[model samples]
Target chain A: MRSHQTVVDSRLRRRRTAETVFRFFLLASVILVSLILSIIVVSILWKSLPALKLSMIFKTPGTGYYLGKRGGILNAIVGSIEISFGATLIALMIALPIVIYLNTYLKKKSFLSEIIRLFLDVLWGIPSIVYGVFGFLLMLMCHLRASLLAGMLTIALVELPILSRAMDETIRLVPNELKEASYSLGATRWQTARHVVLRQALPGLITSTLIALGRGLGDGASVLFTAGYTDRITTSLLQPVATLPLAIFFQLNSPFPEVQQRAFASAAILTLLILFISLLTRFLGRKLSRHRIK
Target chain B: MDKGRVLKKEKGRLVAAGLISFFPIFLTIAIFLLLLIKAFPLLSLKSLPDLIFSSAWQPQKGQFGLWPFILGTIWVTATAFILAAPLSILTALYISDYASVRLKKWLAPVLDLLAGLPSVIYGMWGTLLIVPLVGKFLAPLFGTYSSGYSILTAGIVLAVMILPTIVNVSVEVLSAVPAELKEAALSLGATRFEVVRYVVLKKSLSGVAAACVLGLSRAFGETIAVLMVVGNVPVAPVSLFSPAYPLPALLANNYGEMLSIPGYESALNLAAIILLLIVIIFSLVARLYLARLSRRRDR
Candidate 1:
């Protein structure tokens, strides 16, 4: 009896130890994650504090953007927004029909569906540098240098998989029964899908689109090559322009302390934008959870 | 089976329509078609070894060795995997086997949020926090200047970045473990730790390995954050404090300028193609394995 009780006690004690370890790890993850985000915010703010003067925002870089009075990121900022929005608009226009077709037409796991899925997975994995290079090369053949339109197309390629997948998943969540019910009421397949399926998946579809937006904005590598950083903002969609992420990148590498500080400010703005979108989607994710529950 | 049989009545239009359904697949093809055509000049059966194994990357001298960047990517990814893998696995084990509902409710979302946080933001944080922290505390002891970027710092930041992904994948695997298996282990007088280590972990190691590999790939191709914090030197170095460059960073940094030259431009395009190949292979293998696992679960 004594030996048995000792064994039982040891087992219980071991379980307790495991629980304690688990608790510690969980707490550590929380702290680590929060600390990471905090550092990003704090560092950007700290770096940007000295560089936030009005002159820094309005002028162009001279001598060095940071060292002299002419260094302003206005062109890059405008360029970034233009490219991002343009890419977003273009990618969505393409991805929406694809998603609808996949969910509505390819309802089962046929060979075609499987192939499409595999291709998408591969597309998602393709490096952004590849996209940048490819876009640059193709454009060069057409007598085009790295331009805003080229950059937008490059980013559009990157975001399409993310958007398509999200759109597909959201569309899939639209119950077949609802579609069938709609079909029984004498509606065509597209009409049934349009009215019932899309309505249910709106939130998720929106979330996916937002994810693509975030990816496009955060991406530096693909943009650096295709956009060809320029200080002057232009109205033509085909003209060269700079984006904020690339601006931060160039400024970070600059020898001038002032330019580096401006880089930090840009970094701050970019991080805040990313965080806001992530947090917002999460708030909208409540609808997603509700969808999952069904 | 029955659904297919019933559906086959309309097989003519249904199948053709189904085939036509993925017309968006053209997007994927367009991506590949354009990439291959652009980077085709880089694919030489002659310079294959030079491209893959040579340590030098000076395109001016006609040296196209990618070994340095590849090695750097591998090293940092391995370091990050070593740091995050164990912690993530244990967290998953606990979450799947022991954590209560309320705790999961709180913790799961936090982990999800971790996954969602952008790499750029992570880079910003690393440049500010990890760089100084390492420069101040770690560099002096190692007889080096922190220079605010190191493989060690990059690895640490990447470890954190990928931890949630590892944890999420592992938790999914662990949650799918059969209750009967656990019950049988307990009936045989296995302790909780023993059951998890011997039964749960052993059974799920493949899935965990897959998760780790996937995370490693993410770490390998990671840009922005790694670029910001890494010293961005092209040469290999033994000390963690010494700056190093990986292929992804080098490609992004140099591709623009290199485009001005012709053969040199093709060489750079080739490098980009290689990067794309790596990502596709890694993703496809992982996805196939995952898809198989899910299929098994359904059965």
Candidate 2:
């Protein structure tokens, strides 16, 4: 009896201590990663702080031998925003409806959907640099050539899988009973999906779009190849343009330290934009859940 | 009832929506097709075995061998798998089965943040920190000239990159194994180690395999990090210390300048096409496995 009791007690103690240790390990990894992120952010900020003057932010980099004494990352910043937004808009326009279609008209098309899903996975798994090669081919081929359009198209392809899958997962999370209720009330398949299901899934869909946007912002290799870098404002959408990511890459490669400083600033800004998008999703997600709880 | 008009309108709209969806994906495919067609001219080669098994990859001279790059990709990816899988699975096991509820909640997001970081940042960190560290301690191990960039450098960086992917997916799959299954194992007087190795792992084996494969794919597609750390030596690697070039790194580094060379661009595209084929194969396999998992879950 005593031995049995002692065995059980030891087991309980072991379990308790084991749990504590496991949690500590997980906590440590998290803290370590978070700390690293902060350090990166801070280092970038520190390096680039001297150049964050309003003039520096607004004026473009110089063209001649005075490349280091630039005013701002004006063209690159604007171009990044334009290209990323352009790409996300094109992607969402295309993917959102398909996700809806898969949920509604194509619910029974599981075989086709399965194939498409697999291909999307393949697309996502491809490295960004390959897209650059494809972009060159697209430019070399014909009318739909290199420009912001090509860059956006390249990013659109990259973000498609992530956003569409996010859309599918989010759409699936909408309760079946809600769909059943809409259908029973004499709503068409499209009507129920557009009105009830979509309204309910709006938050998730928006969040997915933001995440895709954030991804587009950070992805460099593909963007650099697709959208050839330029210092000046090229109003023609057909011509190559620069994005912040490409700027970061170019600057990192440049021999000048000042160029490197600009890269850090651009990276810091990009990181901030990404984190903002992430925080917005979590905030909105939490608020929605809290409202539901209430 | 004016149901006929509504039906007509919706049918039209649905068609339009489907077309819109088709167009962007078609755009993605169009890019793929262009890449495919451009490279098709060069890919008509000697023998498939010679292309794959011959230890040379000097496609510039019309030699289509890929043994070195393929072997490098596999060896580095495998090394990453070896390093990351054990830690991630153990971490997942500890979290889902061993940790208390409150602790699990606290740790999940931390792991997620680690996973959420962009790959470029990993490249930056590896270049700045890992490369130097390797030169200090590990260059002597493989008889290198204290060049910090090597296969070993890549393996460590890639291991960090794949940890989140393995852990998150494994946690979900392991948790999905029926609670009753674990209880039954425990009721039979099985030790914690025995239950994990036998019951939980066996039931989750397929899903775990998917996670492992996905990790391999993730490590394989990694470009910027490997480019920064792998030393980009086109020469065949004789040791972990030897610099190597995966296909993605080769194309990324050489493509821009190679475009000026007549056949060089095509050669690069040939390499790109090869990478695409590998991706498609793994993707189909993983998707089939996932579909099976979902179907089993439904049952």
Q: Is the docking of candidate 2 incorrect, acceptable, medium or high quality?
A: acceptable
Error of 2 at B76 (Å): 2.9
> lDDT of each prediction vs. the true structure?
0.74, 0.73
RMSD of each: 5.0, 3.9
Model 1: interface root-mean-square deviation in Å = 3.7
DockQ for each numbered candidate: 0.34, 0.37
DockQ of 2: 0.37
Q: After superposing candidate 2, which stretches have Cα over 4 Å from the reference?
A: A1-56, A63-67, A143-145, A233-236, A289-294, B20-33, B45-65, B100-108, B141-144, B184-195
Model 1 bad stretches (over 4 Å): A1-15, A22-26, A49-65, A68-72, A287-294, B1-45, B94-113, B142-148, B177-203, B237-241, B259-262
After the best TM-score superposition of candidate 2, give how far the Cα of residue A206 lies from its true spot, in angstroms: 1.5
Q: How close is every model to the real structure, measured as TM-score?
A: 0.86, 0.87
DockQ value for model 1: 0.34
| Model 1 chain A weakest lDDT span, ten residues long | A60-69
lDDT string for model 2 (B71-99, tens) is 77776777778988777777777777777
Chain B TM-score, one value per candidate, order as shown: 0.86, 0.88
